[model samples]
Target: MMISAATPFTLLGQNLLLLPQKAIFWEQQKALIIADVHFGKVGHFRKAGIAVPRDMEQSDLATLSDLISEYRPEKLLFLGDLFHSDMNNDWDWFILWRSQFPSLQIILIRGNHDIIADSHYQKLNIELYDELLIGPFLMLHHPLPDIQLQHASGYVFCGHIHPGVSLSGRGRQSITLPCFAFSSKQAVLPSFGKFTGKVAIRSRLTDKIFAVLKDKVIAID
Candidate 1:
């Protein structure tokens, strides 16, 4: 019900808002879809002397909180890679953040980096699933190829590669921007974590790509 600068896009007759936060707001389902937050990444690297910023991890949580405040979504869904490592100091921060939105349902589609024991999330009332089908969308952590997608239970929404799009300017300059890449049967979301990296993807002619800018989302397909 709140206004947003996010770009509205429709898929399979369902309305979606492509957010500059590198996430999606599914209209019909009233769910906020995010991918690859990598909650403990900073702390994980710090343990190994990687020298990443200590406050960077909390900022992502703050962004999620802002989105929840604006959208008032009924559920928050993470496509995958919710945690960058097993357990770290940042986990405590996450626990504190979880306390604020105790009533909000959190669902995580287990990604490769999600190796933490289920009990940890269970105590917080966070539901974990290998894959999920809600409405016309199938939530998955890893993107599937066309061959496999043909057999998907529903139109797949995945986020593991942290998809980006390379744009070449008129002067031979090129920049890679995080993007939402949607095919006929699947859509790959960009990583929601600021500390994560993006992998530029090659899209087919018919694919739809929306690049995420600092304050808005732009359609490039």
Candidate 2:
């Protein structure tokens, strides 16, 4: 769970870092921030007749646990989609998880996929917000559309794209890997959920991009 300091990058006016495990380690608040965990998604698919490994939810939880224990963060922020669906047996796993780290402050920004009742999250004492302002940044579950970009108070951090970057070689080999994409007004985080799919995002020449590989995070020139 112990990780070295994240690689810092400046977006808009705030300082941020890209972590190894597809998460962001915010320096100012000493918080580990991640987006779109989509827990229990595998189960949701499997129950609908799609084949999926049942152990995925546990693995995802383990990853979060490792990050928390390593960083010993005072706060943890989930950008959205912490839960993939309505209350199900898989939700019990999440409830149990909340007990393990009793002192870690948890916050969830509700995403479109978050349809569970408020009572469930309240039981775990996880604070819920449609969006929030932390320092100079505006955190939300979904990225602002073009029309809203000009009106934003500060730089925005959001998810929902599950963004990735595509790499190609001479041998017809191509790979799309998750990435952090920064624009003038906002930054889009790669999905934190291991089971989620990614779409390669096209970036402008001035855009700052970082790709998350298995062992480390690499900048995209």
> What are the C-alpha RMSDs, in order, of all predicted structures?
1.6, 1.6
lDDT of 1 by residue, 106-196 (tens): 9999999999999999999999999999999999999998899999999999999999999999999999999999999999999999998
lDDT per residue (tens digit) for residues 1-221 in model 2? 45644677865555677887889878679888899999878878888999888888899899889888777789999999999977677888988988999998899999999999988898899999999998878889898986898999878889999999999989999999899998888889999999999999889987789988887888988
The per-residue C-alpha lDDT of model 1 at residue 54 equals 88
Local error of candidate 2 at residue 105 (angstroms): 1.2
lDDT score at residue 29, model 2, on the 0-100 scale: 90
Candidate 1 lDDT trough over 10 residues, lowest sum: 1-10
Q: In model 2, what are the clashing residue pairs, if there are any?
A: 1-70
Model 1 C-alpha lDDT versus the unseen true structure: 0.93
Error of 2 at 34 (Å): 0.9
| TM-scores of all candidate predictions against the true structure | 0.97, 0.94
lDDT of 2 at 75: 91
- TM-score of candidate 2 relative to the true fold: 0.94
